[model samples]
Target: MILLIPAYEPDDRLIALVTSIRTAAPDVHILIVDDGSGGAYGAVFDGARGLGATVIGHQANRGKGAALKSGFRHAGRTHPGEAIVCADCDGQHDVDDILRVADRVRTARTSMVLGARQFSGRVPVRSRFGNAVTRLLVRLATRLSLQDTQTGLRGYPASMVAWLQTVDGDRFEYELNLLLHATGAGYAVEEVEIATIYLEGNASSHFRPVADSVRIYAPLLRFLLSSLGAFVVDTAALLVLVALTGALLPAVVGARVLSSTVNFLVNRTLVFARGTDKPVRTAAAQYWLLAGVLLAANYGLLLVLTQLGLGLLPAKVLTEAALWVTGYQVQRRFVFAPPRASAVERPVAEPSRALGADVR
Candidate 1:
């Protein structure tokens, strides 16, 4: 197993972590990526190197994702088919927990092992809130019940390194993207509980709360905005057509036709196109088929609600809201799914033991 640490302008905590790991598991190979730490941090890298870690340097500071990709590339070339466990250099992850995750990866060679932290005692407020929100969003998006969506300690078998390099994002968002795509790429997620350590209230972390949060939530946010735009177009057209013709059915059909076209175009070209290889024609056909079913459901629901004494506008809003989740799921899983790949049979390994209860 190879331990990959991605460090950018790290302090002595990195050296301490390396030393502890070297002491704990002398045979485990340690690979550190100096993500453009520059000449000032030379002593720190040298100190880690002195402890027998192979250091790879970048000319300038790339993001954490880039640093990880560099490490993955190095591991692919040097230690092919070896399990790699990635831990943060901020001294947040315990050496023992890292080793446990590594062991899990070794047993479940096709699974992504995550060292999940239980935020039970004395956690930083920002860290707690961030993980809570991200965990919820990740669960909603990918249907994966992850306790720690933002944990930096993760393990991947060597087979996933090439695919990891292709995942988008150059910052913290990259890690979340990995979780979002893991199952779809035929990798099972296994969690090993780990201690939650926040040294100096996590001051060593380089994550920018506002900027990185935006990047992390960009995919969902973009889809939301696109849906909102389409809703606006649909509502406006419905009201206008209803006013001109004094007919509800024609207005609904015309509005849906217009909005569906706009939505399909936006979703196909922008929202759900990343990492997907489905042809435009195929996606459009599938989208329209789903859209037609949704339109029928939308009109039926709207009609029933209006007949049951709700205002036309209120009923339209309720109907659309009810169908929103279905539309998003169909578009995501069917209309814009990644190219179909043969299923790889995963060996069913014994369940990993949970060391602690999940706090979030």
Candidate 2:
């Protein structure tokens, strides 16, 4: 097993963590990627190197995602088929918890094991609030109940290294995208409860609350915006077509054709993007199948409401409002599901006593 830590402008805590990890898990290969922490932090990286960790450094700072990708590439070339345990260097993760995550990685080599943090007891207000919002968004977007969407302690299988290298984002958004697209990559996700420690309200952390939050939420926000734009187009076309033709069926058909085309184009290009190994035919077929079902149900509902004395405009509003959530859910699950790859599962290794030792 290998432990990969990405460090930037780190302090003595990094040095201590490296020294302790070396003492506790001598056989575990440690790679510390110095993410452009300048000459002032050179001694700390050197100290980590002296303590038996292999330190890799660059002259300028890239974001955490870039740093992690560097580590993944290095591990892919060097270790080839070894599980990697990733932990934060800001002392939020203890050595024992790191090993615990590492052990889980061994057993779940075909899966991504997340060290889910329990946000309790004197946690920073921003961290707690940020996590709460992100958790809700993830649930709404993917229907996956993830306790910690912002956890830094995670384990990756060797099989996933190539995919990770290909993932987008150079900073915080990269991690969120990884979780969002994990299912598409055909990797099962397992979460293990772990300790949450915020040092001085997580002062050493480099996350920008406002800017980073926007980036993290960009994908979901774009989806919503796209849907809203389509809704406006659909509603306007329906009203205009009704005014012009003075007929209910013609208005509905004409309006729907325009709206559906707009929706499909926006979703295909922006929302449920198609840039993967998964063939477009599958998603296209599924999407049209869903559209057909929704169209029938929508027209049926409109007729029923109109026959029961509702006006055409009111019926259109009610029918569409009913199908809104259903459309979103179907598109997300069927049209945007992650592509899965064939994996060769490796055997689980027993935990070493050295790795299991408690070291704070």
Candidate 3:
């Protein structure tokens, strides 16, 4: 098993973590990527190296995603078929938990194992709130209920190294992107509960709440903005068409056609299918089919709401809110999903002693 840690401006805790791992799991190869921690952290990296861990260097901070990829590439070249487990360098991850995740990777060899934190006990306010929001967004986006979307303790089989390297995002967003696309890429995610440790109220965390939050939630935010833009176009066109034609059906149809077209274009090029090789024509066909169904549902809901003593604008608002989640799910799972690779078949193994009940 290979244990990969990505460190940037680390402290003595890093050294202590390395020493503990060396003592607990001596055979596990430790690989650390110094993500441009510079000379100030040289002693820390040296200590890790002196403890028999190989250290990789990056000239400047390229973000956690880049550091992990560097470690993955190096592990592929050096360890070849060994299962890899990634843990944070700040000592939040227990050595026993690390070994547990490592064991799962070795046993499963086809699933992505996550060292999920319980988030119980005294957790930081930002950390708790951030995880909750991200967890909800991930569930909404992928229909996969993950307990911890932001955990750095993850395990991947050797077969997944190439695919992991292909995942996008250079920073914190990279981990979320991986979870979003993992099922589509034919990998199952299994979670193992680990202790949640917040040292000094997580002050050592380099995460910038505002900047990194935008990047992490960029996909969902883009879709939301696209929907809002289309809503404006749809509502305006609907009102104008109603005044011009005095027919609700024609007005709704015309408005939806214009708005859906705009929404489709933006979502395809910028939001869901960006940088993908999936054919535009194929996606368009799927998208239009979905739009047609949504349009019918939209019209039906609008008519029902208006008949229930609601004003036209109020009905429109209510109708859109009702269908918003449905639209995102269908578009993400079917319309814009990438082509899946062949999945490996493996038997479900019983949970290890460190493993907990599965999160819904």
Candidate 4:
């Protein structure tokens, strides 16, 4: 098995991360994908090489997605049969977990194995919220119940390695794009809970929360924009329900039930279009499950907020905002993914020009 590290000017931290992998899994070949780190970081590669890692250098910074594509391509040609696991250059990932996850990938030799961080602690506030939103988008897009959709620590079987090279998203958001595309190609995603070390308060990340959040959720945002009418229906339902039942949980549930169904119907018919490689029966089940989990979480939050010295109306608003993030995370990760059909013979709906995202 080959361990793939996509690095751009890897500092001492990456050198240590690579070193730890060397210590933990000596049998696994390490591939450092250097994206133009300049002369200053050349020593890091030399050190990694000394510690038993093959360095593939990119002349310029081509972004994380591009680096991974290049690295996977290199692994395909060079290692050929060994499985590849992609790990961040940042030291946040646990080497032991990588070993464990990679072992499963090596043994099963099929599914994509993801390192899922325990979000209860260590995760930054912005990171938590953004991931929650993206996770839902992935659920809706791919109909895969993923615990941590944005986690960069992932293992891939060698058979499907080449397809990842053509997919889009060169930045951190590429993780989202990879997952969506993987599901579309009918690959199964497996989660492995990993220990996360957020050094220096997690401030070193390259992802621009708001801008990248838009990009990460690009595919699903388009779907939601197309479903704007459903948003209005949901808000209207909420207002009418509160007026009728004094903002009780049942009323909130009733409102969300009606509104979410409207959104679901629009997504199923419009965004998903029943023609992708995804199995309709399983996808539909995952869709309802995603909505049910979000609805429960939304209403539960409202109940807690209302009981904690706040007005029901404001509580509803706060909880709804929370749900919006949560719902997007679950739906996008599991629901709206591309299908496994080798080729889409007939697109059920023309790609909506109005809902397209500016990836650049």
Candidate 5:
């Protein structure tokens, strides 16, 4: 097992943590990436090395995701098929919890094990508030109920390292992207509850709440933009057609056809194309099926809202707001899902010694 930590401007807490882990599990290989912490923090990295860890240094600070990828590349070349668990260096993760996650990875080698934290009493307000909002948005965006959407401690099997290395994100958003795309790449996320520790209101955390939040929610934002564009097109067509034809059925049909086509093209070409590889016909079919259902549901909801004393414009807005998240979830999970891996990529027929067991 390899314990990979990414540290920047760290203090004795990092050194103490390394020492304690080495004392408890002497055989475990510790790899710490000094993310350009500079000369002042050299003593801490030196102390970690003195305790028998291999410290890799970069001249300039890269983000946590980059540091992790650096460690992963090193592990892939040196340790090859070994299990690796990542933990934060700011003392939030207990060594025992790290070991537990490692053990789970050893058994469930095909799964990505997450050391999820339970934010109960005495949690920092920022931590609590950030997690709560993120969790809700993640659920709406992906239809996945994750207990901890932003936990840094996670375990990855050797088989997943190649795919993990390809996942984009230089900062905190990278972790969220991994979780969001894990299922599409045929990996399941298993969450193991861990203790939540915050030091001095989480001041040690380098996350810029506003900036990082935008990056983390970038996918949802793009989807919203696409949907808004489609809505505008659809509304304009509907009003024009209604005025010209004086028939609701023809107006709705024309508007839906034009709007859905625009939406499909935009989403296929821009929003989801980066992460998805499903064939156009397959995706289009699923998209139209969802659009048909949503079209009916949307019109019905608008009518219902209007009947309940809301104005027509207000009702339309309320109805769109209600279905916006549902639209994103369906389009992401069903329409743009990647195809299953080929036999060579799957290798499910034979037992994978590299992954340890058939946790699938």
Candidate 6:
């Protein structure tokens, strides 16, 4: 497997990181994407070359996304059969985890793998809230649960490079953009728990939560409008069902199932269909997953809002809005992101592991 490390004006810490990687995985190919660090820092990379690392230089600073693209292109040319793992150059990821993901990559064909971090250790408040909010948005988009939206440490099949080349968007939004593209293509994305080494409490971190989040939330924002319409359809159907049957639970559940299905269909075609190859069965499976979750979220929210004294009508209104936003996020991250072709070119014709389940 090949590991792509994108760096800009990398410090001594990054040098140490490369050295550590060398010690951990001697055979692993390391590509350092130098985003216009200039001649002043060329020698630092020179040191890396001496340590047995392959350095790919960019004459100018491109965003993180561009750097990753460069690395993917390099890997495609140099190591076609190897898995591609993307890790940040900020030294926040453990080298051990890189090796671990590499091991999984051998078996995880046709699936995108994520390295999930433990949030219990001094997570920034803004980070926690942002992740929670974004996680919900991703869930709604793709019908999958992702613990971290901005994680830079990830692995994917090499074919993803060709798939992502079809999409646009650079800068910090690149990774999230990749995820959206991948999930849209019907590829499964699953997370592997890993340790995060946040040195000195992330003193060198460059993440701007608010700004980056706006970029990350781009897919979700578009999906939200569609989901809102779905909610209205659900509400109207629910009221009609209640009028006919006077059965709140069954009526609400039926209406929600119908509405969420509309949402899933729209999302599948409009939002995610742009780059998906998920087998028809994969879509059906994901649809069922999405339906179950939507029922739980929408119904659960209504129940809680009623208990909180918001009353049924007002509560339904508020709850519906909340659930739509929540559902959109999940779908983006899990259902339609990081674009890749199904392991089999025609997954619908013959369902296989490449269809029903992600190779995670």
Alpha-carbon error at 105 in model 4, in Å?
A: 0.7
Give per-model TM-scores.
Answer: 0.86, 0.83, 0.87, 0.65, 0.83, 0.67
Report lDDT (CA) for all predictions.
Answer: 0.83, 0.80, 0.85, 0.72, 0.81, 0.71
How close to the true structure is residue 13 of candidate 1, measured as C-alpha lDDT? 90
Best by TM-score: 3
| Model 2: ten consecutive residues of lowest lDDT | 351-360
Off by over 4 Å in 6: 225-360
lDDT of 5 by residue, 42-72 (tens): 8888888889888886677778887787778
What overall lDDT, based on C-alpha atoms, would model 3 receive against the true structure?
0.85
Q: Give the TM-score of candidate 6.
A: 0.67
Residue 30, candidate 4: alpha-carbon lDDT: 88
lDDT for model 1, on a 0 to 1 scale?
A: 0.83
lDDT for residue 248 in candidate 5, whole number 0-100:
60
Candidate 6, lDDT over the whole model: 0.71
lDDT of 6 at 316: 84
> What's the ranking of the predictions by lDDT, best on top?
3, 1, 5, 2, 4, 6
At residue 128, candidate 4 shows an lDDT of 82
Per-candidate alpha-carbon RMSD to the true structure: 7.7, 6.6, 7.6, 9.5, 6.2, 8.9
4 or 5, which is superior by TM-score?
A: 5
Kindly list the per-residue Cα lDDT of model 3 for residues 1-360, writing each as its tens digit.
Answer: 899998899999989988998899899899888887888888888888889988887777889988887788778777888889999998788889888888888887679999999899999999999999999998877778888999999999988887787777889999998898887677889999988888889888999999999999998999889999999999999999999999999999999999999999889888885425579889889899999999999999988888889999989998998888889878876788765432223222222222111100
Q: Any idea what lDDT model 5 has?
A: 0.81
